[model samples]
Structure formats: structure tokens, C-alpha cells
Target chain A: MGRSPMNREDTTKNRILAAAGPIFAQRGFQQATVREICDAADVNLASINYYFGDKQQLYIDSVILAREQRAQQFPFPSWSDDTLPEVKLRKFVGMLLKRVVVMQTIPWQVQLLMREILNPTEACRQLVEDYFRPIFDRLLRIVDELAEQPLTDLRRTQIGFSIIGQCLHYRFSAGVISLMVQEDQREECFDWDELTHHITEFSLAAIRNLGSHVAVKSSPRTSETH
Target chain B: MGRSPMNREDTTKNRILAAAGPIFAQRGFQQATVREICDAADVNLASINYYFGDKQQLYIDSVILAREQRAQQFPFPSWSDDTLPEVKLRKFVGMLLKRVVVMQTIPWQVQLLMREILNPTEACRQLVEDYFRPIFDRLLRIVDELAEQPLTDLRRTQIGFSIIGQCLHYRFSAGVISLMVQEDQREECFDWDELTHHITEFSLAAIRNLGSHVAVKSSPRTSETH
Candidate 1:
């Protein structure tokens, strides 16, 4: 059977979104024009207005679409009920790093999300709630299990931010990081497994120390008498 | 002897640099124009070329000038030789948060540095070496003192990155974070004292646990058989 009218409209919409993602990512919301998106998508100018109503709506949809596409392509690893929390945490960190740094198949989605982060537009709140909050909750659950004591919400939030901050640093400051370290060491630090291991171990050590059983020995180097 | 020729030239150079700092910070390097800077400085068109050679050099000088100005204005807290490493780390994290988040006296410098970080230009290398390297070294030294065992260069680097990452997150993602959490919680989090305290404790705990004496307990909640 031939494609129905609704199918043709959906195809047109998908084409526009596909074209708009990269253009919006590259030029940002202000610089990116509907004309350019339409031209890139090879659709008529009316088609954009007809399908998306306006540029702002188009942008919001594009961001959501990018999130959906990335989630589908590189879904978070599934862990069975028997899996250890530490193992799950490790996998979570690795999945984050891989999706962010290694998955080159959808570079625009990452870039768009990052740009939204650095200079968020109206769409940012939706992006955060829809895309980031779920992942953050997942991380918090894993951290809660790993912690020796029941963590306060504030402490849990701080711990979650710490883990995410480490992952994001590699993406934002990869250039500066490479520049700061020696050439030989850059590969080792940036290597997917190495960075993931470092973050997991660092976080785990800290979480374990939060327990009352562990006495955090004061530095011997401290000259002040306690 | 009124203003000498050399003194007059220096004043003109200073004016251009001051005017350019905000413009470059506001508009970034590419969008910021020489004419606007010259106008803002109330100098002749040719003065930019005469003083700083060109727009690119002028941008570099302005960044350097902003760095020097900020450093002088809000110098990092100096620790006495007898100061405890834990205290030093707390002070370090506090100083960083104050400079990045609370110090409203010179907002442009932070914005300019952040813009450079997101979309680094040719000046990024110089920025990293001249500004970041010294701070990184200081942090490494502090972390070294805190750790019970001697950290490898890679571990030290990772530790330094972890600390810096936590501090930087508040500045960059403050908007998203505020949106993520409840309104009442926002004040507690963005409170300079609270954020600094959280980061310091979190990092210190992690560093202390890295010692050989501390046994990292496996997650009690894990159901998996090891």
C-alpha cells in the first residue's frame, strides 16, 4: 500500500527535526534560522510553520527528539537484581562516559544538550526534567545502596553532583586537560576504562568513609594540635 | 612635568584594556568589535592598533589583564606553614567558590573565562598555563598532604580534577541546579558556606579513605555472591 497522508506528514516532520538538530546545535537557538533548517531538510518554508507552528516549538521538539534518539541508541545498561551496587555504579559511570564521549554516532545531540547547559534557553527546564532527572535519580539510588549509613537528601544530592561533575569535566575541558598533562599521560587518563575506574573507586572510597565505623585520621602533616 | 609621553601612552593602553575586558567577556572574541572597544575607551580608531597591535592581541591582553586584576582583587587565601592540610583544603574550596560564585565585584572575568572554556580560542592554552597551572599545583600539594599513602601522579591528577570539578559545577550549572531542586533548598545550596562545606567534607572523606588503613566495605545491600 502507498504511504497514507498522515505517514507523509510524519516523514516530513522527521526530516525537519533531523535537519534542525544539527543546525540548532551548531548555530544555537538565536543564530539558527528556520529558513536554513528548511533548506537543509529540503522542505518548503510553509512545511516548518505548518508542522511545528514556530521556531521555539521546533527547538523544544528537536531537543526532546535528540534525547529520545540517544536513549534508544545507547540505552543505560540493564542490571539484574543480583548485581552488586558497586558493579551497577561502575556500569552507570561507564555508560555515561560512553554515551557522552565515545558515542560519536550522535554528536549533535550531545553538543546541543551541552550548549543548552552552558547557555540554557526556554527549553532547558524541560530538558533537565525529562532527560537529566531520571538519570540523576538512578545514580542517587545506586549511591544510597553503596553508602554505609543512610544518607541525608542533601548529602545524597552532593554525592550525585560529585559523580556527574567528574564525568562532565572530561567532556567540557578535555582540551585543557590534555594540554595540562604530558602527552604520554593523556591517553591513559582519557582512556574510557581508566577514567571510569578512577571515578568509581574515588566515589566508593569516599562513600565508605562516610560510615561512623571509619575514623577519618587527621593529616599528620597538620601542625595544629586538636 | 605634567603627564610624560610614556605615561600618556600607558594610560591609553589601560583604558583600551579595561574597555575591551567587558566587551570581550560580553560578546566573546569573535562578536566583539574594535570600533566598539575604541568607542567605549574614547580613543581614536588607530589607538587599538598602536597600543595592542590588533584585535586578537588586544583580546589576549584583556584576558590576561582581567586575570591579573582578579588575582590581585580576590587573592586565594594564604595558608601559614603550620596550617592543617584539611584546613587548607577547606580554605581552598571556599576561596574557589567565593571567587567563582559570590565575588560580584568583577563578574566579567568569570564570564569571559567560562566562555573561553566552552568555546576555547587560540588564547586557551595561555589561559590554562598562566592561570590554571599554578592553582593545580597548589591543589596537588594539598591533596598530597591529605592522603595517607603517597598518591601516584595519575591519582593525584584525578583527585585534583575531582575537587576542581565540584567547585566549577556550582558556577556553570547553578541555573539548572536551582531549577532541579526546590526553592527553599536553593538558598541552602547556593549559600557560599554550605556549598564550600559540602565539597570540603565530601572531598576530604574521599581522600582520607584512599589511605591504606581504611578498608572499603562492600555494599551491604548487594545481593550478588562474590
Candidate 2:
């Protein structure tokens, strides 16, 4: 009897989190209500309060859970010891595009993260520290390796942003893009492989061309090592 | 007396628009209320109904006005006959970064537009057609000039998005960026001139490197002309 009740409680908690992710993503923190979340979850109104303490707590928990789920679903591509920087970059860009644009199976997590980014609330701080910072650091390392010259941290960061910005544009402004392009062009632009290829090619060309210029001011570390 | 009353009415109308722009931008269309707007504007609540027909109309008018104001404030740089494609591209990127990141005197316009983009309402379609499309078309023309070989319209559009995506990232994710970079690096990154130089160099290098590849599959027009 005790085990049955505990399992039921766990089920209700999981259900509430699943329901809350989409609602909070769609409505944002200020607009989403606990009642709506409970109704969507098919749990009693009191269940949220019992399980998560309050609506804010539930929202935070839901965001964290969604981040974990997304990371697992589209984990970063790992490079082997012999992998070339160019190959690693292509894979990185492809993985990022997949995470942003092609993952139609579970889009709520992306939507939720985008919503937080646009209209950030308290949970945004945690989301950035826990979820985004590590990914950013990894991207920086990849960019550093790709550079022919030792880049200033600032330069590396800007390059990383440029690459990420291209991928994110498709997600945030798909409607605007579709409206701007010709009807036929829209179909071509949205093709997953085509868009990924364009971005990777575009970024690689820039990185290769600019890498020499960036190395113009060699770091002390380079001189010392040489 | 007739002109005076008319001028007073016009003043009242403008006041409502100015007040509503920030509110609608901050709270979005659904959440922003007429009463709050009236309170902020220090106008009679009836004035909104009397002047603009409804809150939606007022919101639309404010958006239009803000767009006009922004365009006038930061008009796109005009290229001379003697300007090189490389120079023009650099100028275009610099001007765009200025429009997006440096013009902080009045940020409400950018914020309003971004909010509409993230959670597009009916207003977004008109905004894109009237405001964004012209700018996009201009960008396409610029990108076309920079390419060694003629680019497909779709390729031109993707390149434009890539350029714009970099500029918009700073505005939308300033918080996340500030968190990611070191405190001193943040200061350097946000320096309008330094950031503009970096983005321009980054984009130009990429465009130059990718231009030849983009021309590999010539469009029907190229074949026809040849």
C-alpha cells in the first residue's frame, strides 16, 4: 500500500513538470499560472504546492529538468585525439544546428530556453551558469584550436558568438526569414542538411582566412614555446 | 482656438503612443493594459479610445512610430560609386552593429521589435513587411556586390541572416554574455568600435573565403548570360 502511494506521488510530480515546461515556455514566467499547469498535468491543484512548494519553485524545477533532458537528447559531439580542428568545427556547427532547428521531436525545451533568454526571469541566472556556460567554454576551446594564431580571449569569444548567432537566427526568426525569401527559396533554406552545410562552409572559410590576421600579434606564450 | 484644441488633442495622442511603446514592448500586447498606459501617459483613459479606437490600434501606431524614429535615427550608410565591395561590406556590418548595439539612447524600439519577434503577434507580419524587408533587400544587394561570382538569391539571404544574427545576439543575450566572459573582457567586448571591427573582420573574411565556393553552382541567369 505504501509503495503504491509513493509511486503515484512520483507520477504526479513528473506529470506536473512535463506539463509545466510547455506552458511556462509559451506563456513566460509572469503569465503562466499554477492552475493551468495543474489542469494540463491532470493533477489536483494542491498537488503542485505539495510537490514543488510553490509556482516559482515548480517553474525553476521544470526549466532545470528540461535543460537536462535536452542535453541528453542532443549531447555535444565529442572529438577523438586525431580529429582535425576543421572537422571538429564542422561537427560542432552541425550538432548545434541540429539542436536548434532539426529536433522536432521535443521542441518544448528549446522554446522554453529561448523564452527565458528573451524575457529572462530569476531562473535565467541558473540556466546560464549551469547550462550555457559550459557549452560556451567548449565552443571557445574548439575555436581556439581552429585558429592559426593564438587569439586574444576577446577575439575568440566574438568568433564563437558569430558562429552561434548564425545557428540561433534560424530558430528565432524562421517566420521572418520565410517571409523575406521567395516561396521556392524557403523550401531550400529550411532543408536541414542544406542549411547546416552552408553555415559550416561559411564559418570555416572565415576562420581560415581570419586566423592568420588574428595571429599577427603572437602571444608571449607562443614566443616562449618557440 | 480651433487650432489650439486640435494641437492639444494631437499632443495627447502622441503622449499615449510614447507611453504605450515602452509598456507594450515590456509587457507585450496581451499583458499591457489601457489603464496602465493612461496612467503612465498622464492622459485621460478615454483619450486612448477616442484617439486610437482601441488599445490594439494604439499599440500598432506606437510600433510604426518607433520604427520610423529608429530608421531616421540610424539610416543605412549610403555607398558611393567609388566604394569597394570590401569597404561597403565593412561599412554595412559596422552600421548594422551600431544600429543594434550602440544606439542605447532609445532602446525601447529595439526591445519592442525583439519582443514581437520572440512571441510574434499579428503586429509582427506587418512590421517585417514594412520595416525589415526593405533592410533585408538592401543587405542582399550589398552581399551580391561582395561575392566574386553571382550568388543564388537563397545564398544571399542566408549570408544576410548570418551577418544580422551576429549583431542581434549582443542585444538579445547581453545578460548571458556578461555572465560568460570575464568582467574586464565584457568592457572590451561592448566597446562599440572594437566590437564592430571584430564583427566586420570576421564577416568579411568569411564572405571572401566562401564567395568562390558559393559561385560553384552558377544560377540559370549566369548560364543564360554567358
DockQ of each: 0.36, 0.38
TM-score of 2: 0.89
Best by TM-score: 2
- Interface RMSD per candidate (angstroms): 5.5, 8.7
Badly placed stretches (over 4 Å) of model 1 are: A1-16, A30-58, A102-106, A213-226, B1-13, B30-55, B102-106, B213-226
Error of 2 at A140 (Å): 1.3
Task: Count residue pairs with overlapping backbones in model 1.
Answer: 0
How well does each candidate reproduce the native contacts, as fnat?
Answer: 0.44, 0.57
- List pairs with backbone clashes in candidate 1: none
lDDT of 2 by residue, A136-197 (tens): 88888888888887887777888899898888888887767767777877777876666776
| Docking verdict class for candidate 2 | acceptable
DockQ of 2: 0.38
Candidate 1 is scored at a TM of 0.82
In the range A1-226, model 1's lDDT, one tens digit per residue, is: 4545563365888899889999998787877988999999999998988988989899988888778777887788888888899899988888888777633243898888887787778888888898789999999999988987777777788789888888888877666787899989877777676677777777877777765533342342322122
Model 1 lDDT on a 0 to 1 scale: 0.79
- The sequence of per-residue lDDT tens digits that candidate 1 reaches over residues B5-37 is 563365878788878999998777777889999
